[model samples]
Target: MGKFGIAFTIAILMVACKEDPSAKEESKQGFRMTDEERNATPQVQKQPEKNFRTFTNLADTTFIRLADFSDGFAYDLRYATENNFLKEKVYDCAECYTRVKTAKALLMANKEFEKYGVRIKFFDCYRPNSVQYKMWAIVPNPQYVANPKKGSIHNKGGAVDITLETLDGKELDMGTDFDFFGKRAYHDMTELPRKILENRKLLKETMEKHGFWSTRTEWWHYNLSGAHKDKVANFKWECE
Candidate 1:
């Protein structure tokens, strides 16, 4: 072929080889990764199950004072601590609507407890993602705060940190304070007083009955059934 014709053919080939941005994006959208690529890709590590606890509303439990139970707990209590901020606002983790439903379910399940003058005293709930990051930064331990990218079960709107309180508002002795990170929180069946042990057992049994389970470390920590256990979500509870 003549030089001009050859050059023209080469230019056409070059243009054909060049990728169109939109077409390239469409190709990416349609492309399927091979198993090797999928496995080799760095995955976002899931938040480890640090504290293993569950919750339940006792049967026949009653609330005598009818105080706003929601007020006692942090709005973000379910996911991260109050220290986590989003959009320049500190969310109340406990005040999350999803947690309120769970709490209400517990109250409903334990009508007798209400009559007997006992109610749930929440410590924390619905943690913000940013706050979880901060907790991890401080501790760098999954036992305490979840990795920000992975997130905690609380972020899923299903876990709660709580304890039982009497009708007159006295906290039950559950071995250690909520979020206590040592051996004290472990449910050592033989170590605590009989009454305190009984209280712990009672709490465990009641929560288990209503689809919650306690962590091995903290008595007050309980997770709702299969909610936050397996998934990493970006749900943030907003409180005005």
Candidate 2:
């Protein structure tokens, strides 16, 4: 073949070898969206679960790094910085660790949220018991912080402090910020603005449907059903 013909052929082959953008988008949103997502014209199709760690063959009792399994969710991880109510960096690094069951439920819930152009953005997850001690030392109040002696669901890798954010990372207002201790942060605070109420409702209803129960005091806190029975864990995640 002439040089011109060979070059043209090579260009066509390169085009065919290019990766599929839509498929990448699917990974960014985890696999499969709900029927609502499909009816709303989901941007990508659900591919087989291979690229990340799957719950298959794993013990639901095991703790796992959530971000290691999916990149779809956003993370603020306040305790890793001095930005939280503690005002001290309790965690050595920012990470979201949770039991297998909680992580699976979160993934399923996120898929539903994605259907509406939003995803779960976590402020905290699966806190080490040591950090709980640190928080208690600072606050030492039963109304605000759970007693490290009894250990909260967070110490068991079952609870997560999260909020909803758009796919592009714009946070949905829920009347207050993370660790906000007041009536305004209460789930039953109906005096909030209509938009804030709707945002909280979306978060609460979706999380509840996924087997999570919200605490009355903190709108962002959700505990997985049956997880309170798990032993409190103190292992910390490794920093990269």
Candidate 3:
């Protein structure tokens, strides 16, 4: 009786030691990696650095040029026009460049405005870090330039300065000029003419809905969110 009991106990123990067939198969199929094994695996390399050129805004001078789109405005209009604006600003962040594309999309979205002949007029876009440094050196105004250490959103290629005009080409009186830096540009609902103020509101609301935000000091300035927040290599785009 003792020998048989011992034999039966040994057989039961062997059966218990055997792994479940389904679990064994699953363990073979599932992902398994030791820390060293994971460390040994080569990680994907990042994309090669983008080649970029340098471009300086001519308006950086005292003789303010009305950007190309500011047709009637006496300011020198060099990069202000549609044809030249994008190339005017350097593309520091490939991702942030979507702001320009979004602006164009906004224009196309308002097709009815096209019938009325109205369109967005850009004053500036994508300023290079060097140009920003130059501007800061000249003015050194915090109101205009964020600390170079913190960097301007423009430096990241995520901000734009723009205005609106009629299809027949009448510029909406924005209560203040593009670079004006006072209370007038504050999006004051009570100060401007109902129509003009309403126009400002429209521009702000439209741009905000499209992932862009306006600064309090400059109604025309809008920064696209999550675009190129890092300091890119300082380079300019050359005219073709």
Residues 1-240, candidate 3, lDDT per residue (tens digit)? 699999999999999999987678669979556679868968899998544322234221111112321222112132333233223432332222223343343434344334545666656656667766755665677876666656777666666677778766677788877666678888754667888788788778777866677777778888766654544435465443
Worst 10 residues of 3 by lDDT: 60-69
The TM-score that candidate 1 achieves is: 0.57
Ranking by TM-score: 2, 1, 3
Provide the TM-score for each candidate, comma-separated: 0.57, 0.78, 0.55
> Which ten residues in a row are the worst by lDDT in model 2?
41-50
Q: Which candidate's TM-score is highest?
A: 2
Model 1 CA lDDT for position 93: 31
Which regions in candidate 2 have their CA more than 4 angstroms from the true location?
A: 1-50
lDDT of 1 by residue, 44-145 (tens): 989974452233453221211112442332222423343322212244333543454455655553554565566666656555566567566667777666
Worst 10 residues of 1 by lDDT: 58-67
Residues 79-191 of candidate 2: C-alpha lDDT, one tens digit per residue: 98999888899899998999999999999999999999999999999988988899999999988888999999999999999999999889999999999988999999999
For lDDT, the strongest prediction is 2
Listed per candidate, the RMSD to the true structure in angstroms reads: 22.6, 15.6, 18.3
TM-score for candidate 2, residues paired by index: 0.78
